[model samples]
Target: MSADEDRDATAATPPELETDRELVAIVAVADNGVIGKDGDMPWHIPADLEHFKETTMDHPVIMGRVTYEGILETLGEPLPGRTTVVLTSRNLETPEGAVVAHGLADALEAAETAAREHHDGADRVFVAGGATVYEQLLPAVDRLIVTEVHREPEGDTFFPDWDRETWTETARDEREGFTFAEYVRS
Candidate 1:
């Protein structure tokens, strides 16, 4: 299928109005694309953690329901000035210091609106999530900032695979045990 066809098909596959908005997925994965295991990440690198925060701060971080819960438990609070957008089927009783969106399209729309309302131009929106959310948000992303961790851990949850040819590396940094790589869509 063509790009238009792919977008249309993806929009139709899910049962909601498609949102026309840009998004990005920021993640640190292993060489094998393994992200998490047993509902939590298995690695502990201060540099990786700092990179994640530094990249995602001042923007909206879109996530799936489970990812939202995991992030809430893991990160504890919203990153100072950023808005956390949780996409779920359930209508949340409270916002949990974050915004709640109904679906993938809705989540993108929410991010866009939040950016416009808060900032001057279209701001960065990071879909920091589980597999499903990443897959859904991948097509609309402007960049995919991937921190390629050195060791591959056994993971039940993995990052979606993409053609390396489709991305251009913007920056790269290496540490003792891991490497950080940023990819902008080409």
Candidate 2:
């Protein structure tokens, strides 16, 4: 074969399309948009916590370093039954049973890879966040699972402002102290 023919034969094929995976951001925001105060969640609504656990279980979860630390403080370790990817620019040690990524994109990629490897074809990656992580991943999120706390508590962290027109509310469940709402990108 001619040199040109050899080159053509060795050319790489385009990669196959990956399965469509949903990137969902899960957060609990108070009526005044508060998410946290002083590196911890501002409210302790047991129902909201349960809802979060139920929604994110068996899915890959990506979060910022602060959020991961907060979880560690509250729950004693990284969450179980899910792969946790923490995004941080510092040279912090990865939490036990968790993966560390240097940036949001890397964390997300890790989450997707974990979903493929561990979750038996699970299609959702949950972004459980501190404010910075939430803001950084907002543009790419496919769905938002939110717990809207009824009272506005004093808080230092706030959920990023999002355009309501770009998302459609698909489900809502009202509880005693909070309302669980889900929104899909339109």
lDDT leader: 2
All candidates: TM-score: 0.83, 0.87
Which portions of model 2 miss their true places by more than 4 Å? 1-19
Question: Per-residue lDDT tens digits of candidate 1, residues 73-162?
Answer: 776765556777888889875354488887666677778787777644455778897887777666666677787888978998888767
Error of 1 at 163 (Å): 0.8
Residues 7-97, candidate 2, lDDT per residue (tens digit)?
Answer: 2211221122122687788999999999999999877878887888898898899899898988888878889888899888788776556
Give the winner by TM-score.
2
The Cα RMSD of model 2 versus the native structure comes to 10.1
Cα lDDT, all candidates:
0.72, 0.79
| lDDT score at residue 41, model 2, on the 0-100 scale | 87
- Separately for all candidates shown, the number of backbone clashes (residues 3 or more apart, or on different chains) is 0, 0
Reference-based lDDT, residue 165, model 1? 77
